[model samples]
Target: MSSYLYRLGRSSAAHPWRVISAWILLVATAAALASSFGAPMRDDWDVPGARAQQGIDLLREHGVGGFASARVVVHDREGDPLPSAEIGTLTERLRGLEHVADVGPARLSGDRDTAVLTVQYAEPITHPDLMGNIEPLGGAISGTVDSGLQVELGGEVPDTAGEAFGGTGELVGVGIALLILVIALGSAVGAGLPIAAAVAGLAAGSSGIALLAATMTVSTSAPMVASMVGLGVGIDYALLLVTRHVEHLRLGHDAVESAGRAVATSGRSVVFAAVTVLVSLMGLRLAGLSTYDSFGLATAIAVVFVAAAALTLVPALCRLGGRKLLPRAVRRNRPLRTREPLTARWAARVGRKPLVWALVSLGALLVLAAPVLDLRTWPGDASSQPAGNTTRQAYDLVAAELGPGANGPLTVVVPTSATGAADEAVATLRADDRIAGLEPVVTTPDGALSIITAEPAFRPTDERTPDLIDDLRAALPASAEVTGWTPFFSDISDMLQERLWLVIAFVVGVSVLLLALMFRSVLVPLKAAAMNLLSITAAYGVLVAVFQWGWAAELIGVDQPMPISSWMPILQFAILFGLSMDYEVFLLSRIREDYLRTGDPRGSVVRGLSATGRVITSAAAIMVVVFLGFATEGDVVVKQLGLGMAVAIVLDATLVRMVLVPATMSLLGHWNWWLPGWLDRLLPTVRVEVEDEPAPERELVGV
Candidate 1:
């Protein structure tokens, strides 16, 4: 693999324009195709085999499936009764709009100053263009606002019309990344090389996702998630290769030769890191949700393209810039060193007191992880949206006037064949004190199914709501099933919780095996797995504190404490675990390389840290900043994911890499590289830090 990559890099560098042109053409073609034929991405929360979905499908087949409904809440600016004439006109306009099936008579509140009009859609909320229906509905209500009425649209239509992607968050991330790169590389041209490669790769990957959406149900969040991962990994990968190339240049190697050496050595690590991420993402399929599948596939595609760009485009750009890739001082042949680097000194100090450093870092991580014990998860709803959002406004209004459960009503579907059971279920629901209100039963014209709608006294996010669902399911007849948006989301949360361990097992098992194979060591892979888990759990703990516990929720625009999104644990595990392995592979490969060459366990640990610390820190900073930018996004789910990733990267790079890793390796000594004789023979040699010539000796000094 190294040999082939070396040749590929050399050829690409020798003919830089040709390589650059080829990449440009490929990206252009992909973008053109995507724009011409790709489908719009949307979230699909359906769990295929869940009972809620089964009930929904049965109702749809019987021509009695519930239609998507929206509320048009109006309030007179002056505390006076809403004019009947304006209400009549608004209803007529709503009825004439596209996808409008029915507009119910206006129901006035006790004060008569507030009125609620329900509009039902012809199709289900899962319709691909559900947001399209929302626009016209909003237009229909616009005229009423001018006539002294304050109107807000809410319910299924407006609640599902998610925020637009690619806003302030992305721009801020890119800007910060560029600044970090420039400072780290010491040359603007060199810094731009990584940025250019990353952007090109992101463009190609996004187009691929768009094309993928045409063939499958892609989640609306898929592209945003893909972008966040793609940009971070893309820049980090290119930075690794570019940093290696710069080092080769400093050693007096020519452009093409330097590019070849960089690709052969650092590019191998990039491939390994990307493979781990891809493998982890594939584990999302075990989640048994289409949303998870889209997330995995979209992110994997981005990673592949970004890694490819690093191996090819980065080298070409480095070659084209040549000596300019170096800083002005270095290019003028000035002395590059004055004293031992700080990392070398720090590494030596940690090596001397390995036990103390290890225990301290471990204790800190455990403290951060303590919050996971109280972690609560639910699928986000209108209540989780920003307070200023229309859906949230409507949610607050309905809860105030009607009931909190009005925001998420439950629908019970009963087969008409079980007439006695249907009657008994209604009686039981009416008897339950927890029930807020039960609508009259409506049966299909064909008399095949009976639809019973009931509102709960509590909000959907309330823990008791799901408990109520469980109680109903147990008490109701087998023929009666509860199905609605609220129940659907609850079922999804339940399903994800059940399958979380399976996904973690698959991802961890496969990753550990891969790491073991790559390093030809048992303890190293096991250690890496344990360290990665510590960081992941710590991230989850932070999420619980900020989002669930509402410690600093206002900073991120969250108005109230809400359960962590159910899918986040599995999603974050797969993504953060894979990403954490990135720094692990890079750091461990260099350490292993030095250990193999010198046969000095302690010296190798210090030398590896001295050699790779700057690049690792720079790469981690870029990832952290990029993710933090996305943390400011409007969508609560996106914000949580972004913040979680940023926190994980920070902890992984600082405490885990700087303290725990060196401490553990120092304590283990020669055992860090220990492989059983039989196991060593069975594992194929995979060189990540290939050397064509002898490595230079380092001046190891104590702090």
Candidate 2:
């Protein structure tokens, strides 16, 4: 693999124009097509094969919008009855919209101060343009409102708000990355190479996502998430190779030869790191959610492009710039290797007291991970919405006028055969203290099915809400099923929780095997896996504290603490594990190379730390900034993802990578590279830091 990459790098460097032109053409074409044909992004959380889905299908068959409808809340804020004339006009206007099929009769509160209008669309509410089709309706109604009354849209339509990423995050992330690169590389050309490669890779990846959306259901957050991952890894991946290439140039190697050597060594590490990340992301398919599938696949595609750019484009840039890549003053007086750096000294100290350092790091991780015991998962609730958002205001108004339970009422579907059971179920449901109200039962024309609305006293994010659903399910007849956003969220939460272990096992098992093959070691891969898990667990605990426990929620730019998104832990585990493994591969591979060259294990550890510590730290810093930028996004789910990833990467880079890894490897000593003869024979050799050279530069044909 290393040799192949070396040859590809040599070819690309030899024909820089062809490489640059091909990449430009590919990205430009993709961007053009994406702008014209890109599929609209939507978040459809409907779980296939669940009772909620069945109810949705049944609802659609009955000429209703099923589970998809917008609720228009009309209220009098001045303690006067709402204008019935205006309310009637508003309903008619909604009913006249292009996509609106039916508007339910306005149901006024006892005081006639609040009125609720349910606008059902003819098409599936999941249609991307549903909001656009009815946006004018909101404008028309708002124009009719006087100082005495307020009209607002809520439920599904309002829920779709804040989907736009606004490019602020990407710009901030890239800006921070560029700053870091400039500091580390000390040359504008050297720094710009990685930034250019990252931008190209992200552009291609985003175009691919837009195209993929045309045929599949994709989360609106997919593009931002993919960019977040792509830019971080793309820059870091190129940075490692660029750093190595500059070193070779300083050693007096020509442009082509230096680029080739860099690609052969650090480029191989990039490939292995990217593969590890892909493997972890692929595990998301086991999650059985469309959202997971889109996120996983989109990110995987982005990583592939970035990895390719790192291997081919970065080396080409190296050849193009040559010695000019370095600052002239620095080039004239290149720093020479004299004494060991602080990182080397730190490694030696850790090596001398491996047991103590390992215990301390592990203990700290365990303390941070302790909060996972209380982790709870649910879809974001009204409280999680941004401050001053109409959705949040509507949610508050409706809850205050009606009840908190009215925010997400559970829909109970009963088969006609169980009419008698339905009566008993209704009695049981009304008897429960959690039940706030029960709407009159509505049945199908032939009485084949019945729908009962049961409003819970607690909000959807409340823990008791899910418990109530489970309790109601058990108390109701077998033919009766619970459905609605509240119940559907519960179902999704349960499904993700069930599959979490399976996905973790698959990712960890395969990652360990892959690492073993690459390093020809058992303990090393196992140690890496364990450390990755520790870092992720610590991140999970922090998520629980910040989002779940509501600690410093305002500081995170949220209104309050909310239940962690049901799929967040699983997604974070997969992504963080792969990313954590990235640094592991880069660090361990360099350590292995030095170890092979010198029989002294301790000396090799010190040398490896000294050689790659700055680059690794810089890379992790870029990743941290990218993740944190997304963490501050307006959307709750996106914010959770950003925070979880950012926290995990910080811990992995500092605590796990800097402290635990060296400690464990130092303790393992020569045993770190041990591979049984049988296993060694079965595993193909894959070196991340190959020492072998290719044929002489003159003999290479492409040049």
Against the true structure, what is every candidate's RMSD?
2.6, 3.4
Which 10-residue window in model 1 sums to the lowest lDDT?
A: 694-703
Quantify all predictions' global Cα lDDT against the true fold: 0.88, 0.83
lDDT of 1 by residue, 1-703 (tens): 9889999889989999999999999999999999999989876655677778888788778755566778899987677988899999999999997777789889787788888898887887778667535778778988998776789888878877755454787788788889998999899999899989999999999999999999998987888889889999999999999999988887778899989989989989999999999999999999998888999999999999999999999999999999899987787767656688788899999999999999999999999999999998898877888888888887888788778887788899888898598898999899888889998898977888888999999988888888888899998889999988888888888898899999999999999889988888899999999999999999999999999899889998888999999879999999999999999999988998888888899898899998889989999999998998888888888889999999999999999999999999999999997899998888887767656464533321210
Q: How high is each candidate's TM-score?
A: 0.96, 0.95
Candidate 1, RMSD to the unseen true structure: 2.6
Task: Give the Cα error of residue 38 in candidate 1, in Å.
Answer: 2.8
lDDT of 2: 0.83
